[model samples]
Target: MNYIASITSQGQLTIPKPIRDKYSLHNRAKAIIKDTGTIIEIRPLPHRDILSLMGILHDNPVVKANRGKPSQQIIDEESAAFEKAITDNVVKEMGLPPRKK
Candidate 1:
């Protein structure tokens, strides 16, 4: 489908909904836009899942050690909930079917 879009004064152009849907570019998806001399190219960046964040906190000794924590259990529970939220968000953003419990 060919679409003619107007660029705003802010130099921003809205990608048509059909194209966004086709490329799974919803929910603030990142993309690479470049002028290839002959043609302009727009490609959606790869989507990362929660598992990819593993070891992200390793460098943060305070958080990694879990030291000076009074309620480790509560922290663990909240972390689990946060992980679930991240997973759910990724699924929703990618327009994938919800995971079964």
Candidate 2:
């Protein structure tokens, strides 16, 4: 979908609803704009949670504790929720039905 994004005097571009919805970009979400010579590319920023980076070897007995404690149960759960939300948005944008619980 094509959208007319407005560039502010400060050189900030406000992505339109359709494009944002298509790419699962929400309010205050970060993005990466690239100049590819032939065409410009706009992509959603890499979404990551510091807690999610912990416990890289949660299942490994030796490395589990040394890499720092895993995210608290609450933080882990919230990260999962964030992942699900992004996935759901992508599915919806692709015209696919949501998965059944």
Candidate 3:
């Protein structure tokens, strides 16, 4: 289906109700934008929980090398790494000192 939307002066375009409903999109839903030189694509970002991502690294060499370890251990390590990345980014972007743990 082809739909035309006009961008306002503020550079915002409203997603039509029909398109939104078809994609199960709701207010505050996250959308990913991609620019492919020819056209721009917008896609809904699916929500995921930690439980749904468990065991994804089971086949990884590191995980295989360290066999018998619980998946929670890997999850905790990954979570820490993610948190550190966020903290580092905030510190660098805002010129703020690192927080005391």
Candidate 4:
């Protein structure tokens, strides 16, 4: 499936209709871009709501170890931890005040 797409002035390229239709990529579909040294790849991500992702890690060994807790709780905790790390990094980089404990 060789398709050519021209990049616009703003560095955006439109995926041709045939490829979009084949991948079910309708309006506002999200695509993940990756660069693997020699090649770049674009992959369409399935549209799913947060609720749809619940229990996705239910059978995982790590999640199973904390069986009593809900999966959403674990997700929330991890999300908070990630956000904190990002905030801390930005604060350090910008010489901002340390975040209150």
Candidate 5:
């Protein structure tokens, strides 16, 4: 899954479509790009609590619809999903089976 892409004059690198599709990276998705001494690593940032608050502040329709403090059940479900996503990515990177998203 190696790809070579050119950086634009504006200094923005376009991630390949296959990688974006595989990671479910939508428009304006957040990612962390780190210089890891020997190599560079790019990791997508999952939508978290703070991002949810930001969404609410910006009047995101979905966030606005679910306004107010979340219940324990909802919180638990989101946590579970986030954990599963991380686990799935790790397994995939290790060339394991059963991709779950």
Candidate 6:
């Protein structure tokens, strides 16, 4: 599983095609480069899209659904609170003026 690669004058290295194919790496994939005392290691970033993220957490068994039904008023209040938290986080990240129109 070893191959020779050269570092270019611009400080870029070409990871050989065979190694790339074996590791399922694609163009522009992010990697963590570690410089241990004796060796250099490159690790790929985790898959980040929703489906891949869900797959990582899919092993847990589902529990029985909730049995006690809450009153509609309580449910509406809780839903509104959750939505407000999400909206606030989004706005903070974007740093846009409060929604207009």
Sort by lDDT, top down from the best: 4, 1, 3, 5, 2, 6
> Residue 21, candidate 2: how far off, in angstroms?
1.5
Error of 2 at 57 (Å): 3.8
Residues 14-79 of candidate 6 have per-residue lDDT tens digits of 989887777777886767799998999998775565555665534543212222445675677668
lDDT of 3 by residue, 1-101 (tens): 89999999999878999989988778867788999999999998775645679989978997686587788888888799899999899898999887777
Models 1 onward score TM values of 0.48, 0.48, 0.47, 0.50, 0.49, 0.46
lDDT of each: 0.86, 0.78, 0.85, 0.90, 0.81, 0.73
- Number of the top-ranking candidate, with lDDT as the measure: 4
Candidate 3: where is the Cα deviation over 4 Å?
Answer: 49-101
Count of clashes, each model? 0, 0, 0, 0, 0, 0
Candidate 5: tens digits of C-alpha lDDT, residues 1-101: 68999999999999999999988778988898999899989998885637576534566775565567478756877799899989988988998996744
Model 6 local distance difference test score: 0.73
The TM-score that candidate 5 achieves is 0.49
Please estimate how well model 4 matches the true structure, expressed as its whole-model Cα lDDT. 0.90
Query: For candidate 5, what's the RMSD?
Result: 17.4
Q: Which has the better TM-score: candidate 2, or candidate 3?
A: 2
Clashing pairs in 5: none
Enumerate residue pairs that collide in model 1.
none
Q: Which wins on lDDT, candidate 2 or candidate 3?
A: 3
Candidates' RMSD to native: 18.0, 18.4, 15.6, 14.1, 17.4, 15.1
- Which of candidates 1 and 4 is the stronger one according to lDDT? 4
Which regions of candidate 5 fall more than 4 Å away from where they truly are? 53-101
- Candidate 3 scores a C-alpha RMSD against the true structure in Å of 15.6
lDDT of 4 by residue, 49-100 (tens): 5778998998899767767888798888889989999999999999999989
**Cα TM-score of candidate 1:** 0.48
